[model samples]
Target: MITGLRYLNHSDALFTGKVPHQLGSLTNLQYLDLSWHYNRPPYRNVDNIDWLSNLSSLQYLDMSGINLTKVDIFNAITKLSSLSVLHLSNCNLKSIPVVLPYVNLTYLSTIDISENDVSSMIPNWLLGMHNLVSYNGISTDISKLIRDLSGCARYSLQRLKFHNNLLHGKLPDGLAMFSNLTELHAYNNFLSGCIPESIGSLSSSLMYLYLANNRLEDPIPEAVGELSELVVLDLSFNPLGGLISNSHFAKMTKLEAIFLSSSSVTVNMSSDWTPHFQLKNIRMGSCVLGPEFPTWLKAQRNKCLMQAFQLLYLTGFGTYLLKLST
Candidate 1:
């Protein structure tokens, strides 16, 4: 089984009694997916580590739905230095292993340790990744967590997800260092403070930004409006006041960008901050616009006729404000 054997997916298959300790003999395996790719439960070998040591060539490990909460699993798994991807979603974990150190994962890419009990400060070991991507599925202290991952700037990751947790505190300045980030998902947390202004320097490659369901206050920085190619931006269910005055989406035109599929959008604010551009169908709710909605959306020009109208509206508003000052 060590010569030509490749993958072993026993998700739905029954291994009976205990997790087979003999299957770990495959030393040349590269990708080992045990997550029921199409919804399959793995071999019922819940938490047996006797044979996993034989997987020296194992790079990608998917042990989801295994009910493996050994806590010491990573201590043994870290022996596989070639590991790149590790998915442990929905595992019955109460917290991340702090006593263990994952020094061997130098080339690791993504990590999904979600649906567990990691309800505290993220381990500093996570910052060791030089090429880490996604760090989703955490359900504990977050303010300090973001601060810890700030040290992992050498990798320039693209995705960071930490939603549905009781995370409180201000967003960190470390995010500015993630210039290469493409998506950041931190919804359903207890976060507060204004959205950082440094986000203006983020890479244009960013396609998704989910910051809904938090206590983030203040205005949505105008810098966000600069993301000319931004597609999905959700910041719903937050108590962000003074942010309604400016629609941070003022510069997206799509430049002949065509959409061939349906899309989903989430908003957590109390206002409709749409830029005066096009008429793409949108679902806006829970917005704090109260009963009187903003006029920027209705004034946007589909062609060019309404362009003058929008400008005229802005000009009139400015003039009225100037008159009040005089």
Candidate 2:
């Protein structure tokens, strides 16, 4: 009556060949983990996961780094009605089943399918899972993914990470619907267009927002300063150009890290205006923050990163280890 089974704890121990079919016989197993070390090798192959249908009580399943190339993954897990969390990252999944007859996984909340070969739009049933709280890594149409998630899990979803997916599209205004979102990571994609002004609607809840290394070319919305709870804000390496003023950070009292390097954006705050939050790290390389060096830099007693030209403006700024970017 083993209720939990966790494998791959010892790095030297490698389970080769197929996943033990006997695992499905653990009818009372609530948790089963057979994730392998991704950096080593993926040898635990599962040509057929139909065996999983026997574990009706399975609530948590992690088969990451396993070769699931021959299995219809979505169809294999649909019957696990009690499933709450599922991790199948880097499983070499070749295709994703787009439609399911019905989804019995009413309690399913978190799923990570990152680093897979499934280059398709997210399945409708996956988005329709109202109880889903966090989703990570999947290649999909950015616009449709946002629209579907906003339509289905608007209030339930909290964390979303889909960076480095080569996704192209504007972040739709529909993103503003996820009021409960605390972290949104969509960096390193091919995304274009301006960040929607409606994103300010998540002011009370969003804590981490990363959108760096994209092709966005518009000025950041002044409404972004409305993110009162935001702890980190990154909008670097884009072609964005705009005059950023104090009003753009009027309510971000919780922000601790800000990254805007390699952008055309300019910071034009008043000489005497003090930031509401003290940053631990601030990067502004290739940005325009000059003329008379704003006195606000004196209060930011942390590591400062900027271009070599801006260093000439620093006279009496104390406690700043300047890291000049070439």
Candidate 3:
């Protein structure tokens, strides 16, 4: 009898029938992962997870892709005071409990409830997770979620993934509050309006910013250049206008990939102005690049994706004449 066992990983098993409740006897278990895939599963189902409360010492749990429709999730895991990381993605969860009577896991930091149908507001208890750093809840009221997160996880939260959620409306202006935030992905949504100017405030840490395939309009804010650590910037498929000046890339020294394809913005930089970053992939199709192709591109000798720059005006359909030095 391994009563002292502290870690168990039974992920991706084709186990059928009900989830074994006897696992609760492992009171000292600090890590458990019974997650499986939705397509390859014989499908393990858990009608109730009341026994999870017994694993008071549990620090990490990942039950993603399990059938947990009948579980009282909020109440079952609330008492796990030592639990820190939880993943419940694609669990067939219908709703997130709007209110939790009490929250005991003060040290909990990372949680993923993505790909669920819990189309509700960000729960109050979730916003109160004082130490929460990484949250991946599925789309909800975008405005409300940002507002609440700005106040609660302002200093702690870092990565936010709300992409492909059909989220609408403008990104609220208070984003600067997440001082520690590094990656922000809200692409493939229905978000409109200009990127907020306050985004410059994350200059110290912000790295990857993806807002592609949205209806966002207006000029790309110069504040975006303030993200000194930024690597990938994708704003493709939007109807953005105005001159894309050299100031936009003045401080993006670490930038590698940039996608501006199908956008309406004109590259109005001085012909002699060289970019600060060495871009590897550049997609500027259908954008106004030049009467004479910008000579600065010659500086990116290591760029490998020059074919992606099928500047329609300069090179007629499929004519990739200028190649990087490699």
Off by over 4 Å in 3: 38-40, 306-326
Error of 3 at 235 (Å): 0.9
TM-score, cand. 1 = 0.72
Q: Give the alpha carbon lDDT tens digit for every residue of 1-326 in model 3.
A: 69899999989876887889989999999999999866764888898787899999999999988889988887888999998999998889999987888788798899999889887578878877889889888764688878888777899999988887888899888778899999998888999999999999999899889999999998789998788999988999888888788888878889998888788888788777888888788887777776655666656767357543535445332232434321
**Cα lDDT of model 1 by residue, 1-326, tens digit:** 35557776665455444555666777778887766332343334356775666787888888776667653677777787888888887766667766564467787788888877665556656667767877765746565566666677434678888887777777776676767788888877888887787776774656777787777776667787676666766665666544334446656544222121111222223254555446433333423332222455444334321111222333254543344355
Give the number of the best model, judged by lDDT.
Answer: 3
Candidates by lDDT, descending order: 3, 2, 1
Over 31-93, each residue of candidate 2 has an lDDT whose tens digit, in order, gives 778888657653678877878999898888888888888777788899999999999888888
lDDT of each: 0.62, 0.81, 0.84
Better of 2 and 3 by TM-score: 3
Error of 1 at 18 (Å): 4.1
Candidate 2 lands at a TM-score of 0.87
- Model 3 residue 312 CA deviation (Å) reads 8.6
- Measured against the true structure, the TM-scores of the candidates, in listed sequence, are 0.72, 0.87, 0.90
Model 3 TM-score relative to the real fold: 0.90
